[model samples]
Target: MSSSTQHLLVATAALGAVAWLVGVAVITIGIARARNAGDPDATVARARRMRTVTLALTVPGAILVAAAGGWYVLGRDLSIDPNWWIGTALATWLVTTFGSTFGRARQLSLAADRAGEHGTDDEDAQWRIRRVDLIARGELLLLVVAVVVVVLQPTAPL
Candidate 1:
């Protein structure tokens, strides 16, 4: 790849990473608000909004990662064999984007329904929120690992 193309790819990946991190922060804040709020409906609403934003950020980030990986393999004249880190990063992003985001969104939707039908303090709503929160924590951890791996770009034999 030309140096300019490589630099552009790097800049795109960096911007995506920053956006992902900001999404994570938003999610964390939403989770905290949900935990502290006395009104379950409000909590569910906040969570739903936050999850939507998180998914929005995730899509572009995943695209950027995939683009960078493609560039490394095709434009950089590098063998795919040495790009395991990119693969790992992409896999983690897939998990976070599809698995965690969709899963949590479903749970939050259920919680919202329960809150509307039953009550703000409904047991079902609370249970669903707890499950979504657990998933969010796992997603955050996976995101951290993905970011570290991408930044390091380990090229050692696997």
Candidate 2:
């Protein structure tokens, strides 16, 4: 790819990452609002949508990063061993996607099962708390991997 194209790809990847982070924030806020409102239906729907938004954010972000990496390797004419970086990014994507959905499904299912209930029981609350924790951990791991990839990539002049 041309230098200008590479620069554009980098900028796009950066924007995607930023957008993903923002989406995660929105999801967190939605979760909090759901819990505060004490509406299990809203909570369930929000949780499902949160996972969807996360995927919407991360998939494109990962693709952009991969494209940028490929461009870097090609543009620099380096003997780039992309396995570790690619593998790490893939792992981050897989874990974030699967983990978020799995965790949220549990919470949402429980909430739906107990909808029209009087109060939030300890078990349901605990499930939601755990789900949030799991999602947070997965996102943190993804962020760490993404930062490492960006910082550690070979940036020699083409």
Candidate 3:
């Protein structure tokens, strides 16, 4: 592969990994804040939801890793092997961190839901929204990196 293409792949993988790490940190902070909030049920619910999302990411991530590995074996001259592994690790982290957050988020949501027939505290709603926003940001970053990898594919499109 040309040096430029190889660089793109590596950079994409690195960016993906960094984004995932940042997501994990943000979610963790959310969990801590949830724990501090006086609502155990809400925390549990959030944690569960995050867990589901994390698990869902694994299937696609594993496939991507396999594809990257296959590309490497084809003598494409792209060090996608390392990049693939990094991507896989990032996915794994997403699963683990989000899994931890899932239970808590679910709990929080439930509690908030029950707190009132018509509304909930603005703070609680905002907290959950922020956590989801953080996760979404991470996902967007990962997607951008994946697009970069696709664009850098060595094979010419017919």
Candidate 4:
């Protein structure tokens, strides 16, 4: 790859990494606040906002990462066997995106149902909060793995 292309890839990857880190931090803070909040409605609102911000960061970041990686791979000579790292990174990204989306939808639906019923019981609310936290943590882990794979450019024998 040309020096310019290499620099571009690095820059894009760095931005994506920063975004991922920020998203993780936001989710973590939201989780903490939700756990301590007295009102379920407030907790759900905060969580929804946080989830939206996290998704905003994640989708563009994933796109940039994928584009940079794809460019790097395609720019190389075709005679070479494809590296497994790219596939792994792509799969991780897909898993993170899909898993988070599904989890968020479920959490929101449950929260809405709880709100409509005006239930005071903390048991169900706590369970939903924990579920959201687990989902965010899982996504964060996958994002970290994907970043490492892309940045380190590790390879496996084809």
Candidate 5:
């Protein structure tokens, strides 16, 4: 790719990454706030939209990022330090990807709890949803760690 093309790809990837982060943070916070207010229906609604967010933002962002990485590495010789950071970020991404699976399960559980009569008043359901939120929190942490690894590009000291 030309220099300008590479720069454009990098810029686009950065934008997508930021957009994905913002969406995740907003959705996660919205779900947590609804759960805290004892509003099961609102919690379920927020959790349900997570699939849309993941499909629209997270998945595309990940693909664009990987494409940018592949393009950047096309004719370059990367040293251990660069590879180390990429490896670290990829490791976090792998964990985040797996964690998102459980996160989806939690969302389903929350929706199931509110299936018919609005399980807001059911302490058991509320507790279960809260536990589900814990998974969301962990997934969010993994994403943040991946971003940090990529941004900071930490490497071992000689």
Candidate 6:
């Protein structure tokens, strides 16, 4: 690929990753706040919206990651060992974060839906919402570690 094309691909990947991360963070915060309002209908609405948004973000994220020139870490200019560790940390963080949040959000959506239909607060849904927060926070901690790994450029001792 031409130098300009490579630069463009990298820039696009950076833009896409930033958008995805920020979008997820904002949406997760919104969902966390909505869950505490004690309104089943609103909570259900938020949960359903979250599911749609999550999938939307994920599809683009996957495409962007793929288009990142076949993993820039493996590029000839970079040292494979150090870059590989950072890349793995980042990849793991993204996958686990999304998996836990989506799983919890789905459960919350279902429970909240039932509660909305019945016109009563659902303990199950509320519990699930709390779990979502817990999971998000946990993943965020992992994200911090990933960030540090990237910044530190950790590599296995030879």
Q: Give the 10-residue window scoring lowest on summed lDDT in candidate 2.
A: 112-121
lDDT of 6 by residue, 29-92 (tens): 8677776786766766676776666567734654564567355544536664545865665575
Which candidate has the highest TM-score of all? 1
| RMSD after CA superposition, every candidate | 3.1, 5.0, 10.3, 3.9, 3.7, 4.2
- Worst 10 contiguous positions by lDDT, candidate 6: 69-78
**Model 2 / residue 113 / CA error / Å:** 9.4
Residue 40 lDDT (model 3): 57
Model 3 quality (TM-score): 0.38
| Candidate 3 local Cα displacement, residue 8, angstroms | 1.5
Which ranges of candidate 2 are over 4 A from the true structure?
Answer: 77-133, 148-158
The TM-score measured for candidate 2 stands at 0.56
Ranking the candidates on lDDT from highest down gives: 1, 4, 5, 6, 2, 3
Residue pairs in candidate 6 whose N, alpha carbon or C atoms collide under 3 angstroms:
none
TM-scores, each model vs. reference: 0.78, 0.56, 0.38, 0.72, 0.73, 0.67
Off by over 4 Å in 3: 52-158
Of the two candidates 2 and 3, the one with more favorable TM-score, higher being better, is 2
C-alpha lDDT score of every prediction, in listed order: 0.72, 0.59, 0.48, 0.68, 0.64, 0.60
Using lDDT as the yardstick, the better of models 2 and 6 is: 6
Residues 1-158 of candidate 3 have per-residue lDDT tens digits of 66666555545444444444444444556555765685755554554554444434433343444444344334464343544643544454455435433344454354456434334444565465455545545544554454455546434344
Clashing pairs in 5: none
Counting clashing residue pairs in each candidate, in order, gives 0, 0, 24, 0, 0, 0
Model 2: per-residue lDDT, tens digit, 38-155? Answer: 7655665666666666567655655565566556656756453544554555566567656663345455445544543533444664366446745765675576666677557544
As a TM-score, model 4 comes out at 0.72
